[model samples]
Target: MTIASCGSVSATTLGLPNSTAIPAEKARLPKGLFVAKIPVSAKTKQRLANDIESITMLSLLQARNTKLAAGTRVPEILVIGLRLHEPNAAVPTDIVELIAMQRKSGMLFVCVRDADFEGTTRQECAFAVRRALPARAGHTTTSKVFASDWQPAGEATLNATDPAVDSMDALWESLCSQVILDDPSPIDVNTRLARRMQIAQLTAQVDKLTRDHQRAKNPEQRNEIYAKLHKMKRQLEELQGQ
Candidate 1:
């Protein structure tokens, strides 16, 4: 995959509008018969492959257990190898074609890499991927791809001295949580309306809190009101950002 320079492009350039309303449809990890593709060079291929396999197995097992407990169908996940050229170079046509083919087959594609070809941080690379994702609509898009970095946290340290290592279990847990939350289901009109109603209710609560805060005379009471106001604002942001 081509790793674009961070801050090199704006959302507008990617055809994303600056709107407060979240997209009605979201790109999600498939619940059944999905695919994860990990591409690495031959030098680090075996180690990276092992790590990806372990992570996928752990996540799928956990997801299956949760689904079974909820009386939902247990999902089937498959991990496959995907070879890519050097990171800084354009993505190979074959890899792009493969992604298109997989999406057509109703399979989700996740790209697992340790870092961008230019050595960008994992978090930044994820952000770039997110930015590249097309805006969600009522219909499915041709590309349903996600990416992640698997490097150990200890590689980057504060003060360039004492490093903190994150366990593989922790990374897997985090990735699985993201997959579950980002489920690609489209929200129906009714659901959208319902969400809007909830947002309205929360807005009313915020207004009431603001009024109360203004009336609060004692320092302690004012502090409490401010705290409530802060929490309400955060909830509003989350709902608006959807």
Candidate 2:
């Protein structure tokens, strides 16, 4: 059930050299799952290789495909477009097997660089997880596995480049079913006071920009600041969602 784009580009940029499909280890379901679109960079893959195990192997393409069929998926799937990257990235097979044997929770969104280690750990982990689930290929009226999306934003421990979110809107929409767009809800009362303060500031900025656009002296001025205002609005929206 593994899917690659029909287009000619690399999966790293949204296309794959091969349209090969691989099946899962078994058709059984796992206790936990983390379906996410994480951007893994080459540097990040190399650094985290030791932290991972065989359970991260990309042998569960079938289960992953089934997850997609069941209306579940991380926002995006990438391979960093590298041919030499090995599945599991040197993760110990025993550790991988241990993960395979355990029951997991919800899917986690992973963040990775531009398809650098995507083929290595991203796919490997995905395959291992789906493979661990002993489910056979068939439509499920119900499933416990859930999906999430992630983009690396420079976590200090990962030592990787932060992902730029500008071009991932379509991907995000796909992952979270944003096609049925609705007016955002009111602010979450549970949010931290500091975070609420930032949201307030961003709100004020959006209002000011709206005013400036209304009184803009020229089209260029309006357009330039309008983009900035839109950016601020999006950032606020992202934070709110978080």
Best by TM-score: 1
| Candidate 1 Cα misplacement greater than 4 A, ranges | 1-75, 88-143, 149-242
Residue-level lDDT of model 1, residues 110-228, one tens digit each, is 33333453556442112101112233477554432334333222231111011121222222222332332332222232354346557888899999999999998999999999998
lDDT of 1 at 105: 18
Model 1 lDDT, full chain set: 0.35
In the range 167-240, model 2's lDDT, one tens digit per residue, is: 22222222222111111111221233236457879999999999999899999999999999999999899878
lDDT of each: 0.35, 0.33
Model 1 residue 51 lDDT? 30
Candidate 1 minimal-lDDT segment of 10 residues:
156-165
